[model samples]
Target: MKLANLSIAAILAASSFAIAQDAAPVDTDGDGMMSPEEVMAAFPDVNEDVFTAADTDGDGMLSMEEFAAAQEDGLIPAEEM
Candidate 1:
């Protein structure tokens, strides 16, 4: 049982690490907002349409709140960071 528990824990850890590594932080500048370019850099699958939709304020940038809202709206993949 101990060995099995250890194995499961190891597997979970590896899975988490892999997921974390696959998702790049969009705000590379640490400015608390993400520009379209920055979003693209972090998530290659993100395009102009996605960025525009995520920029709820139409300010050409996504604040942390906007980004979270976008994720909730399925405009941005939550796992994509």
Candidate 2:
């Protein structure tokens, strides 16, 4: 049981790391947030409509947390990130 639990924990850690990597590229300015231009540049297929929707707070920029939430909510495609 212990071995199985350890394996599960490792898998979870790796998954989290992958998700973070996937999210990293969106912040082109490296300000730890994503602006509309950054998102557009990173994911060219993304448009203003999707970007506007993802900016839940109506702010012009998206925090990492906002981006992650948008991903979880399916507002942004993971493969495009």
Query: TM-score of each candidate?
Result: 0.66, 0.67
The residue-by-residue lDDT of candidate 1 on 10-50, one tens digit each, is: 99888655543433377777676789998887777889999
After superposition, the stretches of candidate 1 with alpha carbons farther than 4 Å from their true spots are 1-24
Q: How close is candidate 1 to the true structure, as a TM-score?
A: 0.66
C-alpha lDDT score of every prediction, in listed order: 0.77, 0.79
Q: Give the best candidate by TM-score.
A: 2
- Winner by lDDT: 2
> Which ranges in model 2 have alpha carbons more than 4 Å from their true place?
1-20
lDDT of 2 at 65: 62
- As for candidate 1, its clashing pairs are none
Residue 21 local lDDT, model 2: 76
